[model samples]
Target chain A: MRQSTFNNKFLPYILLLPTMFILVVFLFYPAIETFRLSFFKVHPWTGATRFAGFYNFIKIFSNPEYLHSFVLSAMFAFAVIGLGLFFSLLIAILLNQKIAGIRFYRTFLIWPYALSPAIAGALFNFLFNPANGVLCYFTGYRSWLTDGRTAILVVIIAAVWKNLGYNVIFYLTALRNVPQAALESASIDGAGAIKRFFYITFAFLSPTSFFLFVMNTTYAYFATFGLIDVLTEGGPAGSTRILIYHLYKDFFVHSKTGYAAAESLVLFTLVVGITFLQFQTSEKKVHYQ
Target chain B: MKQVKMAVMMLIITVVLPFAVFANGGVDVDESATASIEFWHAMSGERIDLIQSFVDKFVAENPNIAVDVQYTGSYNDTLNKVKSAYKAGNAPDVFHSYEIGTLGLINSGIISPLDEMADKYKKDIPWNDFFTPVQSYYKYQGSHYSMPFNSSTPLVYYNKTFFEEAGLDPENPPKTYKGIREAALKLRAAGHETPVTWNLHSWYFEEMICLQDEPFVNSDNGRGSELPTKVAFNSAAGQKVLEWWVGMEKEGLFLDVGPGWANHRAAFGSGEAAIIMSSSSDVNRLTAALAEKGWEMGTGYIPRPEGAKGGVAIGGGSLWMTNNHSNEEELAALKLISFISEDESQIAWHKGTGYFPVRKTAMDQLKKEGWFEENPNYLTAFNQLLDSPESLNTAGGLLGIFPEARELIQSAIQEMYAGKPVKKALDEAAAKANASIEEWNDIMQ
Candidate 1:
């Protein structure tokens, strides 16, 4: 790796200043403030705070709905990551083939990447809505939104569908980078197609997979708030209430800042713990070439 | 910039100084009294134009007052904007909030009570001429805290065309819970899959409880000096409302469109549902929507349970004056809201949108113009309001934690739809609401 030398130390510091300022202001300051807020009881309108010493934490922890949301969010994140990556990789592989109008297919397949989650949710909502829905018309008007389990599935499907284009884009790039020489040699050496893919291509894709795993986890945890909000609004008996959605209702809708801060802390810790676990276990298997 | 600041300072002194002196001594407001103030509102779409039209008229008439009107998003979004703006010390001189937000805003201490402002400015608002229900809803601690602009109640909107097709009388819409069910059965037998739906909202729940003349909260429906410690939504009245609601869903007679305002309207507009309980303000939109489908829409008071004697509570937004503005700006905002609520503006607003005219005089004006006879659907909303007996329950509940409680009740309804027993669901919702109420009280302390 070539390293560039800076002519002036002050110049290097000045170059770093803007990003550092943003980090402190947008990220670090809020994190510290949230941590502090988690321990207090906050008046919603007046913005007054009183030190409550674990009251807010205890309140959320003891609530079954909050616990349900926490578990639901974790499961939802994993489901999104697993299904999003699988379908996208499959589609990416197919699109990589030299077919007629491949460029057109690729462009169309990746178009959903440009859409925000709320739009995706709205589309899915219209298609599957029980009353006069286009997809509901085909499904004999089965009500998908009113049932708890199915509503969660609907949200998951919407989230996965919204995210597929992004995943496919990255996977397509990774598939293209797979060395043609190694694949040809493996084929010449009598390796079957499946064996070649597993032994060679899959190994190279691990690094990309690891990168996607982290990104998708973050996306599932955070990015799906808008999708869930628009589609279900954490309803059907709060079955679709993911942690971020619950946090939003608490902080924004209900105006319970202290409780929301405590909830956010839990969510933050859960995401961090998952990412740390992933790095510890999955990072070891990544084959960086 | 320094010179500009100096000019602004001079302007404030020259303009505001005399206004303060005149405000203390003079009975008449100076037409030349100049003050620029921002008015943030939650009304979107064409209503923005309607609001601007009247405000423009007011601005033209009072040439010195520059009103910067902004269309902030929804009621929730507008309140959030005000919160941030207030913390930043640039809150709007006046902003709009919904009916349910009355208690929280009162407790929020960010508002200048309208009665106090009226007293300070020596401007007597036509309180006696204002509608009783509308005025009482905003009266906190025996004082008017906000100016009621748009007052609405939920009404049962039925498709007259669908009713006639179903062999039900188009003129005689269902007026009771049992009547509604029978009407639904007739409509469904006539090949309508779902005969009814309302947006999955606690507003209907709250209204139904009120229709029974039952208080939603124990402390005089949170109208007393004591803050509401718990909700009455788990009581028999509340459970009865849910049982009917969830029962219709179970029998596949009601379409559950979840929360928010759109889906239920969509269901009714497309003839997927023949009857819907929605805001009185939805009269114009839903009527137009059904007309697009060549269906005639009818309006009725939202059906009550058998022998229920209570009436509907108001369900729209009001304009609140913020505490931070200068007296000059305050006086200007007062004038602006007063003008908006007057007979002329209220009549225009009522005709343009289905929201009720807050003033009795406006109602009389609309009646004199023969507006209701031509648009009888409009009369149903007004008659429903006039017919309502004044009571603590009919006045509507006030609570510092109403927003959270509303969500709890909405989720409980969803839970009931998911096959949870009505009583259990209401009980759980009430429990959670009580807990939140407790927490809010503690925090406010």
Candidate 2:
């Protein structure tokens, strides 16, 4: 009995040993090293390393550019996610109608997510070209990348466009999963289309909407990083400077690996804190009945 | 369970034994016939074709030796790849590096010291024949780390049509700071919306450094034991340059045509902008692209303020050998480097890439062959940079952590362009740059 118990207790760990080893090799070790390095100042170009005590972090916090990058990152995340959810929800409701070509509409809505972000950024760069861009033709604006206010809008538009399809698919699936009987019962009670959706359909889709809120927030902050890096490079004048862009510049461009690590850790913490806060605030409002 | 354990052990043994055997077998591999060297470089465009042809000829001539060349993205990307590969114990035998910040690589022992090899090959290399400024950019702590590869000097490229339209002499481009402003005003009057496009920010500032006779950093851009300290770019000369840019902005003549040389060149090439400051290496490609467009282009030496030093630094990359190789592999790599530095190879590279020849012998050959008479733009960089034979700044600054320093300078410039107070941007950049240099100094200590 003892032998069987011992075998049973150790077997799970034995089964998990490979995954643990892989994680240690790839993720855990790098994270630990990055944490250690955040306490040091080193020249990235020369590979010469030395220990520093919180100086890198202190410098990161003290620098105005780094601070600006953090604020911009948060703003970009919310703007992209909020705008994306609002539009995707609207599209979901429209497609939910028994309109002709409804199946075709759903497929078309999910198509943008199939393309790579790099390709998307490149295409948008061409479209926003000052001299010969399609948008430039309409707006009569030269040098779209440099204009401060418009540059931010351009990045948000690209972010929203790239993510619209994925959110639509998510919301559409949730809308379909909502109990038809609940929606029908509301309509049978002399409720109009708009009334039925707000009262019955919205409550049923709340869980999925909440789940998408968390997901869209994460995607907006992280996945759009490479797109921005390739596109404007946070430039014209850093009008579009974001957190991941700052981290990349600090690490690869500036060669301040330690400072970059500290910035990344702080960014990760902020993301986690915000996510937890969102969960705490919204968990009570979501209904499962 | 026993069978599974045995099979797992067998798999582990199978995986480990071959690597051990391969390591042991390396000593017995063929050495006398010829050692094949793997060289990774970042040169692309027409230059890639030029290098491929040269390597093909070299392989045909020296059947015993074979060279495998790989394209490794931009200079910055190549630097990162090489450094990471070195740490992982898998660097290529040879790679490309630039002058300014790469000296840090040598100091950190990522690259092999080429002082002894340079001495041994000094006569063959015609080291004295190389322009002194170009050579200065490659040496670290009085020791050369790599052969001078594609070398260029910063110069002015102007649209001839715009100059003519502005009632300015197309033959005479700006030769002084006052002249540039006057010409810009004329171009603006001629209906060019943006009269001046100052791309390659370093070129304009490096010229300003020369004009001011001010240093790029503390202790002569890190030539001595002094730390980099703060960036000195916000000096009177730097502010003057920034004010000049701001003045142009006010006049509606200044435009940021993207951050890179290619973008600015494209803007001007496409007729959106009038003048751009760039390396002479841009001439051939620009000429070829503009040839079909039927627009005349003009080339001139970079303008300087009156009574300012006028020598420009070299701006292209060099071939650096990594320490992650055997002695034999390094020697083979050196042979390839030596081959590329020969007259025929250098001339081919010059004609192909618009980069000036690094050797007097190659230049002499090209001159005799009528390359200059046929393509005068190719000679502009050589003539302007080699004008002074003994100037230290002419050789280019070799800061310990040069790329980072450039980044600091770029960030400061970006801030200034973004409308930050010039003084504040420069001061902040200087402080941050000093912190980085101090960190590098600490590591060296």
* TM-scores vs. true structure, each candidate: 0.94, 0.88
Where in model 1 is the C-alpha error above 4 Å? Answer: A1-6, B1-33
Tens-digit lDDT track of model 1 for B1-445: 9999999999999999787767557345564678999999999999999999999999988888999999999999999999989877899999999888888888887889888788777778888898888877877778898899998999999999989999999999999989999999999999998889988888988999999999999899999989889898799999898889889999989988778888888889888899999999998899899999899999998989989999988889899999988667888999999999898899889888889999988888778888888999988988898899999889999988888888888888887887889999889888888888887887776
Best by TM-score: 1
Q: What DockQ results do all the predictions give, each relative to the true complex?
A: 0.64, 0.22
Clashing residue pairs, candidate 1? none
After the best TM-score superposition of candidate 1, give how far the Cα of residue B207 lies from its true spot, in angstroms: 1.0
Docking class of 2: incorrect
Model 1 global lDDT (CA atoms, 0 to 1): 0.89
Q: Candidate 1 recovers what fraction of true contacts?
A: 0.67
Tens digits of lDDT, candidate 2, A1-289: 3554454778899989999999999999988888888887665644556778988888889888788887888889889988999999999888888988989988888888988888888788778755446787688776676666777888898999899998898888888888989878878899998898888888888888888888887887778876786667777556787888878877776667788889888877888888899889988988866
What's model 2's overall lDDT? Answer: 0.75
Error of 1 at A257 (Å): 0.4
Q: What is the TM-score of chain A alone in each candidate?
A: 0.96, 0.91
